[model samples]
Target: MAIKKDMLVEKYIEALESGTIPWEKGWTTTRLHNPITGTTYTGINRIWLTFASYLKGYKDSRWFTFNEISNEKKFHPGEKWHLKKGAEGVEIKKKSIYYNEVEDKWYNSKQYYKKLATLNDVEKEIFKDECKVIGDGKGSYYIFNADEIEGIASEQIIEVDSMTVEKMQTIIENMGVGYEEVMQDKSFYSPELDAVITPPKERFKDEAAYFKTLLHELSHATGHANRLNRDLSGEPGSMSYAKEELRADIGAAFLMADFGLEFDESHVQNHLAYIQSWAEVLKNDKNVLLEAVKDAEMINDYILEMSKERQLTLTQTMEYSALDINEYHVELHGCDEGIDYTVFDNTYRSVDGGIIELNAEDTLLMNDFVEFIANERLNIDFTNYECKKADYEELMEKVETMCLLDEEYARSFNVDQMGYYVSEIFDNGEVVLDAHEDYRMFFTKDEAEMLSKELPMSHVTDNSEFVEILKSNIVNGLQTQSEVNEIYKKPDIEVLKNLKIDKPQINKTMTFGRGR
Candidate 1:
C-alpha cells in the first residue's frame, strides 16, 4: 500500500485515543538496523521501526527479510528457518534513488537537491543527470524481526553500563546553556531567562527522571535567542504551545534513544495526562505531530552538534541531519511586507529546519538576512530561491510525496494498532483488556482465531472495537461482521534478495480504523 503523508499522524491519533501515546514511549539509543548486514535504517524507517519494535515485545533488535535468512542458510548450508507458524511481518517503503557520483554516495532526491544547491552553476550543471530520482523508484517490502522467526540466532545486545547514561549528563552540562537548580517543586526551561530551572536531582524519584526532565527543558532551550531561536511566546493550551510541548517530548525521545536509556517510567503517568490535554490539537491537526517530530529531530541535531565532547558516545542518522549547500538561488517569496517569514521561513530550511529564519528580525535586523545565512555555521543548504508561498508549499508537498520523505515503520501485526484485544474465554466474550500501562511494557494477546500475536501492554486483546465497527457497518447495510474480520491485513511479503514467500492470500475488507 502507498504510505499516506498523514500515516504517522493517523497512528498518533489512534495512540492518543487508546491512551497509549506512541511518541511518549521510551526506546533504546541504538538506531534500528539489520543485524545481518550491520547497516542501519535511515530517516522515517528508524522512527517507525522503533515504534513497531515497542508495539511488539521484540527484545532482539535484529530484523531481516525472509530472503536474508535464506541467503544466510546458503553460506552456513545447514541452519534453516521460517517465520513462527502464523507470525506476521511488517512493511517499510524502500525506494532506489539516483547515486550522487560527485559525492560517490547516494541521497534521497531532496537531499541531493540541497547538496547540489550549495555548489556554483558549473557544479550544479554536472549533476543534472547524475543526481535525479524517478517517481517509479518507490515501493514497499516486508521483513520479520528476529523474534518473529525460529532457527535464527538473535543479536546479542551489549548492556550499556552506567557510564553510558552518565555521558548524557556530561553532554548536557557541557552544552554552554544556562542552568539553575531551583528550590521550587517544578522544573522547566525559561525562555525569558534563557536558562533551564529544575529541582535538584535529589528531588526526583530517580536518576532517570531527573535526566529526562533535563532533556526536555534543554529541548525548549533549543528555541532560545542565541540557539534555534524558536518562538516561545505562546500561552499555555494554544496550538503553538501544544506544538512546542509535542516537540519537546519528541526531542527527549530522540535523545533518550541515542543515549540508550529508557525514559524513566516514573513520569509516564504525568506525561500521559499531558498528552491527554493536547488531544484536541493532535486529533484535529493531522500535520502537527509530523511537524513536531521534525522540529524535535532538529532540536536533537543542535544539542548533539553543540556537545561534541561526547559525540563519540552518541550516534546520528546523518542522512537528513548534516547540511551542505548546493546551487539554488532558491527563494521564499516576499509579500506586501516582504518575506512572509511566518510561513516561508520555516519552509525554506533544507537541513533539520535550523533557526536561520529565526532571530533575524530581532538580533540581526541590522545584519543582512541572506548574509547571516551565508555566514552562519549551520547544517543545511539554501540557495534562497524566490518562490511564492503557494509555490513553496506545493514544492514541499511534491518533494515529500515523490521522495517518500519526512519523519518516518514496520509491522504486519494484524490489528490496526487500535489498542484492542482478547484474553482467553471471558464471560464478556473471547476478548478482554490487557491493562496497557506504559509504552515500554510488552505482552501477548492470544490470537488463536483473533489477533494471534505478542503485543505491548498498550494493547488489550479486546475485539469489541472490531465487533462494534462490524455491527455499525452491517446495521448500515454496508459491511458485514465477517467482512470486518479481514480489516487487519496480512502483508504482501517480498524478500529483498528476490526471494518471495508463498504466503496465504487474505481477502480484502473495508478497513475500520485509521484514515488514509
Candidate 2:
C-alpha cells in the first residue's frame, strides 16, 4: 500500500495526543511472522503490520489467512469434507498437479491453481434418539490471529534456527565493536567508552532482529574518538540526537542489505518512526535527507573495511564522508593541472574520473594527517634524539651542516653530546608514541620540512643560517670562520648534556648528532 507522509504524520500526532508515543512503545509484538509461510515482513509492510497488531492488542504474534488453515486436499466426487459454522472460503494459489506423458509420471506444474479456501469441521448432534451433522459457512477470506485457530501444535510451528543466523553472529563478533548482553530492554552505544550494549538475543523476535539491532549500535560506535570522531553530543530529544539516530538507522539498513538479512516487523516499525522523528526535526528538508544518506553510506563503508571478505566500492571511496572531510586539489605526477584530481581524504578522484582508492589503514593515516593540520594541534615525533626548545635554532643548523658535510651522517652520528648526523642515516626514523596518537613523526628531511610548513610552526626552527650552512657545506666542506663560529656559538654539547629541559620541548623536536 502507498503510505502518505501526511497520514504518517497524522498518526504520529494522534499518538502524541493520546499519550501513546509510538516510538517509545518499544515493540508491541514480541514475535512477528506469518504462521503459514513463516516469512517475516519487511520494509513498510512490516511497519504497517506492527502498527496493526499494536492497535488491535493482538496477544499471539503468529498470523494466518483462511486458506492457510485448510489442509492441502481438495474436494473429490466421494469426499466427505464439511464446512463448519462461520468458516470461510478464500481464493488462493496452489501448485497444479498433472501427468507428464513423456516422463510417464505425475508432475507438479510451475503454474498454480487458484483454489477457493475451505475448511473441514465435523460435529455430531443428538436429537432424542438420532444424530445429525450441521454447519454454517461464508465466502470471505481474512487473516486471523493464531489464538483464533484450533488444533495447532505449538512445537510443530516453532521456527528452526538457520545457518544464516550463525554466520550473522560470527560477523558481529568479527566487526570488533564491543557488545554485551544486558537485562535492559533498550539497546544503545556508549560513545565515551566506545562500546555497544543490547538485551539478550532471545529477547528479539528472531536472530535476524537481534543482528539488526546490533548493527545499529555498531554504527553508532563508529563515531567514537578513535574512529570517525563524529559529534554525538546532543540532548536526547534534540534535533542533533535525532540526526545521529537517523545516521545509525540508515547505516544499519545498509549493513543488513549487504549481509542479505531481512528486517523484522518491530525493526521496520521502530526505524520508520525514528526516521519520521528526524524528518520532523529537520522540517522535512530535502538536503538533510541526502546528508543522512551520505552519512549512512560512509558509516557502512567504514564498517566494511574491518571485514576481510568485503571491500569498499568506487563510489564509497570517492564520496565525501559525513564527518568534516573535504576534497583537496592535489597535483598528480603525469596528469594535467585542471583535471579532476580532487583528493578527498585518502582516496583521490583521478583525471579520468575514476577513483584511486586506498586501504583502510592508509585512509586512517591520511585522516590523522588532515586532522592534525586542520585542528592545529601540536604533533611531533622524537625517535632520533631529544632536544630543547631554546636550542631549536642551533639544532637545525647543526642538522643541516651534518646533512651537507656527511651524506651518511644520520647513520653513525649518534654522538652523545655533539656533532651532526647525515640525512641519509635513518630510513624510517620517526615513530608516533602511544601517548601522542594525534600526530605522526617524520625523520626524512623532505617530510619534516613539509610538516613544519603545513603545521603551526611558531615554535619550529627556521634558521636561515642552517639553510646557508647546508648549501655551503653541500658545495664544499669549508665554511667561513664567522659561519662556523655562529653555528658553534649556540649551546655546546657539554651544556646540552648538563641542561635540564621540559618534556613538552623534548616531544616538540627530534635531535640529531650526539646531544640527545
Candidate 3:
C-alpha cells in the first residue's frame, strides 16, 4: 500500500504532540545517502530520511533499495558488478498507489516488500558461471539500511562525506545574515538582533548536518524586520508559530534545492511534519504555499544580491549599534535615457560612489547637487529607514518647514521627466524616498535640504545632478517587506517555482481547495 499525504500529516502531528520533532533532536546531524547511486538525497527525500533514520535509530546513513542490492551481477560484456558475500536484504515501508476501478478513484497506501540480490562464488565453485541469488522482488520499493544486510562490506556500499567545514562556513557567511556559533545545543534565529545562532560545527555529526541545521535557522532569519518580515512573535505551538516553522522549513528546502545541496528522507519528513502541524491553521488557504514560496525566493535572491553588491577592499572596520543602518552603494545602469538601480548594504563607509550616464550639459548641476547633499547630511539623520509615501498636503508641509520655502515657490519646483517632484531620504542611507507616480513622498528629514536651493527653477528635473543626489542618498539597510514587495511580485511565480511542492499521485476530489 502507498501512504497518503493526509496520513503523512497525521504522523507528523503525532510526533509534535509527543515532543519528538525530528529536527529538535539530532536527526539533522545524520548524513543520509543512497548506497547504489553513491549520492546524497536532496529536497523532500532529505527530510524524509532524517526523520526515518532518527525514529528507527539507524546508526549508518547508507541505504539501498531491493533493486539496487545484489550479491553478484552477470551483465552483458564487461559491465559486471558484484555484491559482498553473505549479503542480505530487509523490508521497509514505501509509498505506492492503488486504483479502485469500481469507484473510479485512486488512493495511496503503504506496503511492505522484500529486496533481491544475486552473487557468484567462483572460489568455492558453488556457482561458477551461473549466479547465486538471494531475496525477492516483491511489489513496491523499500529502502534498507546497509546494517540490516549481513556480510555487507563497507567498501561495497559508498559512504558519502559531508561538505567541508570551510565550504559550509563560506556559504553561511555570504547568506546576507549575521551568524554565530555558540556552545548551546539548539539553533535559532534572533529576530531582535536579526542574527542566527547555532551550536559549534564540531558539535554536529558532520559538516553537511551542520549546514542543514544552519540553513533552517537562516530561513527563519529571513523573517526579520529588515528581511522578509515574517511574524515570528507567535508563541510556540500556536497556529501562527506552526505556520512560521513551515515557512522556514520549506524555505530551507527551496534554498537547498537551488544550491544543489544533497538532502535525505529526513529532510522531507521533517518538512512534512512541519506542514502537517500547521496545515489546520493554513487549511483551505491555497495562497499559504504561494506566499511561503515567494518569501523563500526573495530570501534567496536577497542573499545573492548582497553577495554581488559586496566590494572587498583592505580598509578599516567600524562598529555601530546593530540597529543602525549602514551606508549603501547604489549602482545605476543606464538604459536608453533611463536607469535601473541595485541597492545593497555598504560594508565600508569610505567607499562612496555612483555611476551616472547623463549628457555633458548636466555636468554643472553635479557640483551643486553634491553640495546640496552635504548640507542635507548636516541637518538630517538617515537611520532605520522607512519606505513609504505621504500625501500631497504632507509633502507640501515638509517642503515648507524643512526647506523654508513658500508654498508657491515649492509648487513651482520642476517635476522630473518622470513627473516626480521630491526626493526623500529615510533611515540615513537605508531607504531612498522620492515622488513615485502615486505622488506620495518617501521618508525625508529635511525637505529643504533634499530639494534644490533653487527649487523654483527646473534644477530638480531629470539631469546628472538629480541622479547624483538620488544615488548619494541611497540608504544601506536591510530591505523591508515593502521593499521586497516592490521588487518581486505575485505574477512572477511559474506554477511550481521556488517551492518543493509535494504533488501526491492520489486522485483528488478537490486539489488545493479548488475543484479541478
Candidate 4:
C-alpha cells in the first residue's frame, strides 16, 4: 500500500496537536550517538555502527567523521578536535537499495514486488529477489570512534573488558541482580527475588544468541515491585503469561537493537504457537502493539541506565590506552631519547602525556595528521602549577625532538635501482622537501611498486641515500644494502609512495617526470 504523504502529514499534525505522533506514540529510539552531529542514527545505521564499535573494541560509542574532526566547520573556530595520529576510520555505507538496474528506475520494496507480480514470467524471473537489485552505491560514511580523537571525553566509554561478551559478563556481575551461569538448556528469570539464571555464553552459538535469552530474562526482572512494578502472576500458556512474554519479546528486540545484535527471526518461527497467539491478539486489538513498545522502551532504558553506572565505576580505575604506547614526560625528556629516556626535574614537573610509540611511520607523518596533545590531569607532588612556563618551553623542545627521532620508518626497498620521490607537492601548489628527510628515501622495489599505485602524477629521481640506521628494518631480508646516512654508506634510492607513475626501473643516473 502506497502511503499518502499528505494524509500522513495531516495525521502527524493532528498528532502534534494531540501530544504525540499517532504511530510513534511511544517510540523514539536513539541509542547510539553521533557526537559530531549532536544526533543519533536510526535502524540499520545504528546496527552497522554498533557492529563496527564492537568489532573494533571501541569503548566510546560516539563516532565522528574526518571532515568534522579535521575542519573547523563542525565546531567553534579554532576548536577542532584531533584524531590520534594514524588512527583509521570505520566505513558505514549509506544504502541505496531501492535502486533498480533493469528498466533503470528506483522503487520501494512493495512497489518492486507489486511490479514483479504484474510482470510476465521472463520479467518476473528477471526481477526476482535473488537479483543483485539492492544497491550499495559509492556513498559511504567514514567515521572515527571518540576514543581515537584526542581531548574528546565521553562518559559512555567503558573499559572493564576487551570483548563485548566479556564486557557484558562484567556488567552482569556488577548489576546487583541474582545471576548464575550454568550448563543447562533453558534460561529464565524469577521475579520473586529479582533474579536471572542462564547458561554461560559458551553454551550458546555466539554472544548474540546468548544475550537474546539473557535480555529476555532481564526484561522480566525489570517487572519487580521496586522496578517497573509489572504484574507477573501469569500461569503456563495463560493469557497473562502470553501478555508478559509479548512485552519481553518486544523488549528483547529493542534491546538487541541497542546492543547492536541482529535479531534472528528463526527463534520466533520455531515457536509458531506463541506467534499465532500474539497475531490473534493483535488482530483483535489495536492498542496492544503501542503498549508493548512503550513497555519495551522502558525496559531497555532501565537496563542501559543501570548498566552505565557500573561501567563508569569500572572505567575510573583505568587509564588511556592505544594499539601501541611509549610513555613521555616533558620534564624528564632533557636527556637522549630511547628506551632509556631521561628528563631533568630540577624545577618543574612534567605531566604524563600518555604513551606514544616512536616509530617513523611514513603514512601517519605525510598523510593527514590529527595534532594530538594529551591533556590528562596528573596528581603529582609539585610546588606550584604556575611554575611551568619556562620548564614547559624547554620540555616541549625535547618532546618534539624525541618524537621526530623515532626508530625506523615506512616500507623498505630491496631493489637498489629504482627512482624515488625527492619533492612533495603541497596544497598551495608548493613543492617542498627538507634537506634532512633521509628516511623517506629507503623504500624497497616491492614497496615502491605498491606505492606507485596510489601516487599522484609527479617527478621521480634516482638520487639515493643509504641510511645506516635502517639496515635492521629491511624485513624482506634482501641483500646487504650500501649504507649512506650519518654513517655515510653507499647511496640507495627509494621510491615515494605518493608519486604517480609506473615504478621506474632506473639506474642512479636516471631521472623521470610525469604530469597529468
Please report the candidate that would top lDDT against the real structure.
Answer: 1
> What lDDT score belongs to each candidate, Candidate 1 first?
0.53, 0.45, 0.44, 0.48
Q: Give per-residue CA lDDT, model 3, range 391-481, as digits (tens).
A: 3332332223323322222332454343434333335742222322211222233433333332323322223243323222322123433
In model 4, which runs have C-alpha deviations exceeding 4 angstroms? 1-163, 269-271, 309-516
After best superposition, candidate 1 residue 263: deviation in angstroms? Answer: 3.4
Show where candidate 2 strays beyond 4 Å. 1-175, 282-284, 309-516
TM-score of each: 0.50, 0.34, 0.34, 0.33
lDDT of 2 by residue, 238-271 (tens): 8788888876776676566556565555765565
Candidate 3's C-alpha lDDT? 0.44
Pairs with steric clashes in candidate 2: 409-421, 409-422, 410-422, 415-514, 416-514
| RMSD (CA, Å), each prediction | 29.2, 27.3, 24.0, 27.4
- Per-residue alpha-carbon lDDT of model 4 for 336-380, expressed as tens digits? 121112232322123333333333221122011112332223333
Q: Which is better, 1 or 2, measured by TM-score?
A: 1
Worst 10 residues of 4 by lDDT: 362-371
- What's the true lDDT of residue 425 in model 1? 32
**Worst ten in a row by lDDT for model 3:** 110-119
Residue 472 C-alpha lDDT in model 1: 41
What is the clash count for each candidate, in the order shown? 29, 5, 42, 10
Q: Can you tell me which runs of candidate 1 are displaced by over 4 Å?
A: 1-11, 73-78, 95-139, 161-169, 225-229, 305-516
